[model samples]
Target chain A: MACSCVAAHLFHGGDFGMSVVIQQIVTGLSIGGVYALLAVGYALIYSVFDFSNFAFGCVMMVSAFVAYYSILAGCSVAMGIALAIAVGILFSVFIELIAYRPLRKKNTSRLFLMITGIGIDMAVTNTAVNLLGANYRPFPNVSVTEPIMMGNIAVGKIDIIALIVSLVALGILWVFLEKTKPGLAIRASAYDTSTAGIMGINVNQVSIIVFVISGVVAAIAGIFFGMKYAIYPSMGTVSTKAFIASVIGGLGNLEGAVIGGIILGLLETFVSGYISSTYRDLFSYGLLILVLLFMPGGLLAKSKSDKL
Target chain B: MKRKLLALLLAAAMVLSLAACGSKEGSDLPGITAGKTIKIGFVGFLSGQDAYLGQGAKMALEDYIEELNAKGGILGKKVELIAYDIGMDPNTETANACNRLIQQDKVVAIIGPESTEQAMVAIPIVTEGKVPMVVTTASNPLVTVAEDGTLNKYMYRMCFTDPYQGTALANFAYNDLGLRNTAFLGDVTNIYCEGIQNCYRDEFTKIGGSIATEEGMMASDVDFRAQLTTIAESGADSILLATGSYKVVSFVAKQMRQLGLDLTLLGVDGWYANELLDLAGPELEGSFMTNMVSDDDPIFADYIEKFTAKHPGTTPNVYAYYALDAMMSIEWAINQAGVANSTEIMNKLETMKDVPVFTDKLTIEPDTHNPHNKTVSIIQITDSQFKTYKLYTPEDK
Candidate 1:
């Protein structure tokens, strides 16, 4: 089998060279970058609330469909994206208020809250299935499908764009958390909501802000993913990967989720590139197990507890 | 009054228990009640992953029933089709629907559950009830055979089975394209995909083409970069995607090209849909897939026109055509046999030949009850439109 590949590449004149390896990594990173964008928000919610906002995935799906229809209704690509983001924010805050806020007020158990989140995820995604049908709704062309070749390595336009957007989003988030007053209030609340409230931050306002930010980021991820792949009701369930990334990043660490997502993506690509695509999932989830056993706090997570 | 109420409750309980045991108390499955109409049952996934399959079949059935009734039905009895949607959900609802169509609908015959998995589960129930069921798109051989490989007397398939199409695809790849090395990527969990994979492996290897790699994919997985990257490295000139889904294939095609693998893609009739072209976009321009007939084939222009008029801007996929043929074949069988009994109609179908179907001439093999000598149109997607490339027929060898 290996000999056949070597012979084919040799005969074809590429020789399975370094260029191909770089190309695979670049492509994998783009995919991983999208996962990080999603998982970071997932981690942030988990960090502040101490419960998985599983409904966040469904919110992203809702945004994806909104963007798809916006494109179909003759909206420009930029407007479609903007519409998706606005709708995403709406759903995010809505779910937060309806599904989480009451539970928070009542001081529900984390398990109960997580279960409610799962219930919301199912209800919304399934409702979409009922209303929209499970057929694949192809997102209209937003970018050229051509690859931009830089010397030896060929890069997809979507790939380069997704990677750049993800980095910028993450950079903006980092700066907001480190440099601004609201960002400081958000961080302070995440540390201790009661203490932050006592120190003059409105905890309810902080929660809304966090949800809106998550919605904005998730909406971007949803739009890009819908373009690259087809959009359907169940596309939101792809958040299973984000959930895994969040856990691998020690449950609530932002920077750790990003690293975990990229690492998982690279590992999957490398495994499929070198060993076998069949084992890609095995190695990826296997790495998850390995990480849990050795470094449960993740590469960047300071402790097993909360950090935003 | 209390004693009377207790006696009434006891009587109702006994009656309900009896009904549960009978399970056939419904009025729908009345057998040949000498009505002024002949009834047949249709079941398909009108919702979920295979929704369009059922939706297309529904469109075909509705149009066909209207056309048949206008022509005074099969042998002068107005044809009444009792249709049901299985919703393509993850449950035994398909089996339940099959049972209802068999025990409740009480039609002379049953038409379809376009999904192979649904058909596999439902066929046994239909067979046990001794109703003749001619499936449309579910082509796995097990559909027409028992596990021990005996021919099922009642189960019939209107479309060519997987083994034939699978062999034809391999032959096309090796002989027509002159490709020596090919790889197989499919869902091992899928009964339909696995059948095609196994058949492709045997036929391609028999034709002297080596399989560079064989990989597995889950239907739920959206990412194929890893599996595709592996296939790319294997240096195969083409990839035979045995999966029976548009979304999975579309993602793989785009990702395959993105990785710069650029291998030719081949698939079965499952790739026949306008949605596939939209989802795959430019990446699938040169890819090939076997179809019963291309939508643009002049032979189907009339059918397309009628369907589009009925559906308003929707091009009928291969499943719709197959369902139309299924209904037509059942009507022909009833006409040839000149009776409404399922046994006689099924016997007539066992030896059906040269029936004018939507695709072309179709003949059912007497021994296996599968379509014989059916034409397989090799279709190419050029500029995102389906164009006929060539035709090939499969042999058992």
Candidate 2:
């Protein structure tokens, strides 16, 4: 009732209301889309490796720097983005070989891998600090300021572009995973690594591909993050929220990640509109803990084992 | 066997004599460098989140030390500077660096740990060691004072505390801009923010201004729409933000624009950065901030010229100037004491008054151990750059 009253005050007086709410929601969705992509990358890696890739965020940070420096070096925006993706792929492979492969050979447990992941994260994050120095660097603005009008609601170019890109990327990923041979191999590897290896599928190679894909997605998220907010050494900390989203969405389920991301976005927008904006993260985590206690299996979870 | 024994005895005698010669060389410079060199160790954030501050401090120290050495060193002996990186985890690294410097490096005096957290941690260490220390950028008044009304004899700061900067902003807003009603958005976690907020409240209320609303946000928060909405509805003519992180400041600016709030914004020295302009875009145009150091100051211009001429390719920053001035103050104390002893330096530092530096006429009051008669400047964001409006001194209205 209080929220409605405020809404009425804003609407009737032409002060602020539906348009502001819509604007907030669009902004949240764009941000959440970036988070979702980042969460998907973490989920894809975790599902296969049974360990959270902490360096994933640093990988994103480093890719952002690469993109920034490339643009400064006289490359076009598109070329800079491509270079960033390439760097991400290479860096992910290097990290897997140097930091993960040795531990994998020892048949490290999930806990051990998790500890190693933290070490990698610290080392990589600090290395960025050493090379780039600790200062916020602004990305070159793309100047896509034209707002698109969908009926009475107006959306900025960034929001529309983000939504379209995220949806397209997810669609391609779904098609590839469900309808392609490599996707089937990846699924088989996820189901049982040894059996997939015995079935003439190179499980190690598939894992590498998954890591590379995750790196690419993370890099895309980082570029958008830099565009939206300024890039800095500690920017990786912001991704932890997205990781929470993945767990809430059902850690291994791609659909769950997407649903979790959208729900988180909408909830934040609504709460900022009604309750308060400062408590948005608090409400998100509170709802997540609540969902975990009751449902256990996320809102769209399917696997019986996942319910546990 | 007899020949071999004779040769071994001769070799031992030669080694001992060479060691004696090395010791003699070390002890030759008496008075200023009696027994050993005067080691001035520097501990600051050299790596991790805020490494830029450390880098700036390091460059400034290098330039100042070079200048001092070129002028025949401090007290007629070459000054030795040993620096340690505290990263940005001040609680752990500051203490560790202090112990390493005092216990192991045997430094006579120390400089820095540039941030408030690190400086606070270094206070006890230096006091216990009875070593005089000049903190590089700790702007909190608590750094040089204790809870029991005792001044920290060995601890000193060269930067103007946040309270003074806050009062400067209040004066600018009320007296210059003619703003009477204000709102506040402050970070609850940061001592720097809290200090500035308190000073702003005290000074603003003292000037017949009314605070319309006061809101708190965490430093890590990236959104300020709700807070901005409340301020917009509070009918305040202006808002004051006391926050350290540039990201949150820019977010507040953006949210203000989105809500169509036309209130003028004023901030403390924490808002001094080009990154704020880039992040806030045109939304920050006409917003004002109080700066203890500005590029337009003639003293700063000379320092920049000398620094750039030496370093080449490195841009001069306010942090660098503060660090250089801090070291210069230490040198002045050493000169006034006329000895390199810690007790003498501490005693002389307490008596210092009206010592001219590049930016202002700074003096340390023995009672409070806080600087007096410091200069502050009012600056506004114009065309994505900081432009100086007027300089404020303690004598001026």
lDDT of 1 by residue, B224-306 (tens): 76666667667788899977788888888777655556678898888876778778757788889887766777887887887
**For every candidate, C-alpha RMSD to the true structure in Å:** 4.6, 6.1
Interface RMSD of 2: 7.1
Q: What lDDT is reached at residue B68 by model 1?
A: 85
Q: List the pairs of residues colliding in candidate 2.
A: none
| DockQ metric for all predictions | 0.39, 0.23
| Fnat, one value per model | 0.37, 0.14
User: Over 4 Å off in model 2, which ranges?
Assistant: A1-24, A46-51, A93-108, A141-156, A188-209, A266-285, A304-308, B1-36, B222-236, B250-262, B274-283, B395-397
**Which regions of candidate 1 deviate over 4 angstroms?**
A1-11, A17-21, A150-152, A274-278, A293-296, A304-306, B1-36, B394-397
